[model samples]
Target chain A: MSSTPVFITGLGAVSAAGTGCAATLESFRNGNGNPCTAAREETPIAKPVFTVGDPAAIANAEEMRTLRLATLAVDEALSDARFRKRPSDIRVGVCLGTTVACQLNDIDFYRELRASGQASAVVFDRYLRGNLSAAVAERYGFCGPTLTITNACSSGTDAIGMALAWLRAGLCEAAIAGGADELSRIPMAGFNALGIMSATACAPFDRDRQGLNLGEGAGILLLETDAGVARRDAPAVLTCEGYGTFGDAHHLTAPREDGSGLEAAIRGALTTAGCAPDDIGFINAHGTATATNDAIEGTVLARVFGTDCVLSATKGYTGHTLGAAGGLEAVFTALGLREGWIPASAGYKNRDTSIPVAPVTRMTNVTGRYALSTSLAFGGNNSALVLGRQP
Target chain B: MKTVLGVHGIGMISVCGRGIESHADAYNHTQSADSSSPIRVCRVADEILKDRVTLKKMRRADRFSKMSALAARDAIDLAGLRVSDGGIRLGIVVATAFGPHRATFEFLDEILDFGDAGVSPTLFSHSVHNAAAAYIAIMLGSRGPACTVTDFQYPFHAGLMTAAVWLHEQRCSHVLVGYTEESSTPMDRILAQRHRGQPSHEPVLFNFSPYASKMFSEGSVFLVVTRPDQGGVALDLDRFKTGNDRISGLGSLWAAFKDGGLHLPQH
Candidate 1:
């Protein structure tokens, strides 16, 4: 890859926290999370879920909910980047990560087919057209490469990382990258079956954390190469310095107990950025509040960055948005660096004694040039991104 | 400048058979369309998927994972590389249009039969799209970067692009990049409904029209790609970016490789 810096020209986010970057920052400033019971009629489980406040208002009836969420974030990102639409002259790739959107797990369609050997083609058609990155590229007239990453939970981070590679390789002058997923009964039932769904709100990294609460939303970034940013005269406050990903090669559902894969990914990101561990201001951890995830991730964080690395888990505010977690946390990390403060790790009242690291308990000011965001996903995929702020 | 990657080894499994030799043989002697069946569906035989030795550990794995693992393992073996060998940072990238739909439906069946809380966790875990990549990683003991991408259009091309980027960035010593798809009952039903009255015949290669009749197939293809200096069939990554409709899916890419139609640049 080229040595040129990939600049984050715009940011867009939507979750239980709020819609758009401004609203999300406001929610972080207040340190209050909105966790409610699954309100969709199709969901049988009564576990708490973090859903976007209004989806119908943003999307038409013909579009799938996941595509709707993605479109909303992409539009906000484009607007923030001062473009009404993708530039006509430049090549811009669209790489979005998604889980729920990639599968054809429509229960009603399956039920109908199983019963009568026939079903409506609407669901099938929607699925065929709902490849997240392709849909975004079509919507925005992006003419560069397009890919929809489906590496389980770390998909968004991988998508962003892939886009970074594309930019550095000169495949595209700019790219729209991140992740999006909508609340669905399929995952709700699946997660509940796995016994990882928390009955109440999630408390990531807390001592008495039970498990994770599902959430729905999208997080998107408009990343541009140095030349692209300069050509458009766009404000460049933060640069995506580096990205690294590695697999545990151990289990499908569980992370490696040793955290070797995650450590390698983090160290790889640091090495790519040419920075030491001490230069990082804070880390946005993928703390899903599940017993195994927290224990393993906490151990790795303490081992790599030491116990006082100024890290926090934001899943407390957004729930475990699955594919969107990485993207949302990346945006949150960049926001923290640019805005000069980090929010308290919400829902974290007591730290577990077994884990050496305690997350920031209060809204804290930070002065640093760079921050890190990490995601450990199912299928034992671990990914990390290093974002640097311009002094 | 375009990045040229060396195709160190290739592995594939399809209706034609298993391994690159089988593919080359099938390409040399093309079989006439089977007119007996109303729908011309190219299905991988059950025998083609049976590998008791390599798949002993993956007994519980779905067909998607099994197919992916078999092809990936074959590629690694053909490349004369062992996962046990130290200092080999092997990365994996698997692309698919529809990933593990059969497993997903099975998980849904569990959900419908038993309530949400009573469903089986194993089925739920396997239903994920990345399960195949995970299975490959575990089978090979590769601890490098692994990624899975899904796209109806240009999935194989996208996987190759990502693989090239990983190689250029020196993320891994060698990358196992491939595509896998499984034909499920619902997919067949959809295809049947879409082409209810159309005549059934073998797919016409290089037909890029919008309204062409479609015949669906299922299988996996993998290639071990390394830097150009490795001295193998050189693949120009720029050719993929031009949106060559003739070389769109895995089937076409496999055919191109088997027929030596790729026009690989000489190093």
Candidate 2:
């Protein structure tokens, strides 16, 4: 945990589960999930995906869908933080993580350019203006350090960690940090090409798990220093206690077989928090249901937290949201810490004997102060966050 | 006590060439004005990327990853540091304005030519923004904290800030922080269209005007930063500056470092 107090005063999330935190909690409580097959127009492959309902309803005319998702979550976070408008007294920064938003992979625009040697500048201009953090900072008129972390799947977790670093460094008093990525055909195609897309819904850690299903959403946290929280009189129920990230340095797209990288990250987080493995109440795993990912992550989790450690993989509720996975899981972990309960890890059936641990099959109650959320990404990046509730 | 960071070593690759010495040579010698092409872009040469040893580890890596790995390796070598020697925790922070667009476009071409199902998984994997950072870590066998940050403005500055935080927080013993960008055809076309009427010239340094003639350039620059107590050349992070009218991404920083624009600390 950081010596300097960093509180998550507010939480905002929008996903296939629903548009707000309340709706998502309701879905979680009911143990229900919403996943549908991709429309033929979206992609030729028939893969299940969890997409936000009616993105157009929340988006402006000319903004990217990814930005629209981010805007919705930001609006909700601000409202949850009890700020009617931008706070004038504090230096607020914007740090966001994203994968699709950082790429210039507009298929139609590229097709046009490749065919006619010239394409419309509209898409290019939107990309130029759509730096995730820059757009959010410009929209709300924030004047502190702003950055967009593109560390693949761990981007969101790393973004939040970076914000904690910023606050500890006294560069910003408050920050809006998390991640947002839209469900686009580009990644769908890419993952399909990689043969990691399950035709049916994802079943993380299940014995017969196929692969991961893609999802789209945004998850944002209103993080503030102790002074900023006191200034706003915000309810500081949850705190970002510790963060640790380590690279495997092994493969471009696979976890290290030995799982030492992930082990170090988990240990690093625990060391930072000054807590023992037994103190952690539960873990929200980065269980993408792909065979290698589950095996490696499961082995590591079991090694660190013991085979009997209470854990759940929420990716079944929200398909693997890529960069947004860490943010959404972080918010879910904070909620778990605050609500004193965690939903069942959906879609899990029998446990894989090859892996030592199994996820919770039903709703469970917990009474610990801290919970861990872990994310593993392409490029062998593993990140873990320890969230705590005020005693 | 305030934490101070020093630049222990620097490695860079640009259109001018590779290494700090090449950059210094380019900084001292002025280039004759070339008005040959309206689309002014200073692209890294294929010759500069022909390192056999580095290429052996990164055979399938794209140009973006290639550029980033070479520079990062050079920085470690110049620092006379062996990551495997001591239990030195070496963290890496790679910053980029646009990341690996050429690979992205190539993946798109696969979709257009061979259909989505037929696309190459290797291409898809390499198209991601962090592939460069991952390649750097693998080439050096570094297992420390690695992050890749993106921004349209001040990416390198943001990277330096992240590195400073890591150093101060004692997350790592040394940090290889850098920025990498690659010139792509689609981006070149966009730039040509955006700057169609303006006169193109070699980018002028230290001209902070809004309307200065600037050319798009692509390369990678990595700096080995450690606690000031470790000692090399002091870098005052407080005085670091960034602007839209700068020469280019890492090119501008390399020029400033070589020109002595960044003052050494009094300590």
Candidate 3:
């Protein structure tokens, strides 16, 4: 067989639980609430915001605004995988996904430049477009491939898939793959304009689910080829078996009601993994609290995994991290495999009568070999990734 | 060892000249134009562009997608593949550091100022990061797997790798790979604000081929790849492999392409 098995050696997350990966994982295990009430908003916000602590505390270093979340995730992942010395000998690559690329910074600088026509070198420095990925590569001194995948919500997932392909193809010895999107007014206003923002706490797979609370965070996984792993001391956390991607092509902002595209993506991923429907032990669904996405995802899951498979949508806790959703969710699935415990859906309450699928309502002691992580984007693109447990 | 996948046709548009001949000539006579400072020359002149109809409708279409479509069309023509008559099973893969940046900034400005008010649906629709690939698919009527990859470094190589994998899997007979970047007003304004000393320059395109002589410029480039038995476009593509002698596999790619073509200059 020409297939090469790739392993996930490192894991990191910079989410509501602060910066470190272990802290975030511990917080999740303890079922701690990361959501906090916003002080600026006039109205009493129903849904809590998971801002990465005070922006001012970390905002002094403008570069931190561009890469703080990424730095946290990458650091934690590198530590978790126990790859001590930075491996520059082999081609080390990075793939990040995000829609909010320092747009806030650009907006702040543009206001000055547009009005005065006098440009501040500091103003436009962070928005240099390639600065984020280049910064990561530069900081870690990994001289290989570096890319940013920005397909809205699927950006992180697609970046991971791309990294997986690169590793299998022997293009790079290892890759740091994930996505980061700090909360910005641009996305906040865009979602609000679309009328998808829920004034109350967002609930996934719930009958009364209104919408999603826009959250900001980052997650990264360190993947390596077989040759690179020979030098590693720590065992692999999980193996990325297969990935499948397909566009909606039906609509620009909405998913197909028939769930054709999502079904195709799910089936394609399963086929690539050489797995049957029953082989999927856990499903990290793209259960954005949006009505259409949850309903469509429910229908697709019923068709693919049936009603019996254990499932939970993590957005209720993480909020919709936009581009980082896939990466963060993938870490959750991988961690689930390592810990032998399935995390609950966090906020799912009443089941939607219209959909046949049921999300696992509480934490369960489930030991399974394979987990499927999925994501759906604004452009009707659907991506499914199958992560196989370490052998 | 994997079989060598030869390249038959390639096209690109950037700050560089367009067409295989112009690209070859521009690079054959290598003289750096002093554009006011240490700034590099990058852009495709308007005079050399063919198939103007394809770009007429996309008003807000950034230079990135326009360059990609134009170069891809050129490659398709160079390969003698006519979609008007009967198009083959074609796939397109494009790589970029960013996508439709001009449109994205415009949308941001409008939405921010307008305060979630009624915005241009057209602008909002085309502002997607994948608009470049989607537009190419629509233009070519290619229903195959069309993907746009965005990564800051080696995007072109990444795009080609994707195309190669698709071809290796026999998913499609031929795949067209493109790389595009456009100078945006936001970028310019920001650059000027950040660096008062630097001068801004226009962007251009440059095409590559297994047959074309070397010249260095970045814009858009498309390669039409075919399986060995097809005996299609008579160009060599095996020379572009980045593998070393240590690997026993892919020997054909190494032998057939051993220094037969001009290598792409590092960015």
Task: Give the number of the best model, judged by lDDT.
Answer: 2
Candidate 1 lDDT, tens digit per residue, A240-312? 9999898899999989999999999999999888788889999999999999999999999889889988987
List of clashing residue pairs for candidate 1: none
Q: What stretches of model 1 exceed 4 Å from their correct place?
A: B27-40, B203-212, B240-267
Question: Which one wins on DockQ?
Answer: 1
DockQ values per model: 0.70, 0.66, 0.21
Fnat per predicted structure, each in turn? 0.76, 0.79, 0.18
lDDT of 3 by residue, B3-46 (tens): 35556566656443665545444434544533432234333554
For the second chain, the TM-scores of the candidates in order are: 0.83, 0.85, 0.69
- DockQ comparison, 2 vs 3, better candidate: 2
lDDT of 2 by residue, B1-267 (tens): 234567767888866678866765655654443243336566677888989887788888899999998889888887888998786889999988888988999999999998877889999999999999999999899999999988766677778878888988889889998888787776666666766677555543222122334666677778999878877556666655544234233344455555645543221
**Candidate 3 Cα outliers beyond 4 Å, as residue runs:** A26-48, A54-60, A64-66, A88-90, A102-105, B1-5, B8-91, B116-125, B138-146, B151-154, B165-173, B190-221, B226-267
Q: What is the DockQ score of candidate 2, to 2 decimals?
A: 0.66
Q: TM-score each candidate.
A: 0.94, 0.94, 0.81
Candidate 2 local lDDT, residue A333: 91
The interface root-mean-square deviations, each candidate in sequence, come to 1.2, 1.7, 4.0
lDDT of 3 by residue, A1-391 (tens): 2368788888888776556656665666665445666522232223465677645534644664537777778888888877754674778888777767723335555566556755566544455533456678888888866667667788788788878877776668888988887766555555766777777767888899888887888889899887788876556768887777765655556777888778877887787778888888888898988999999999999998887778868777777888888888888878777777766676678989998887777777766678899998865678888888875
Measure candidate 1: CA RMSD. Answer: 3.2
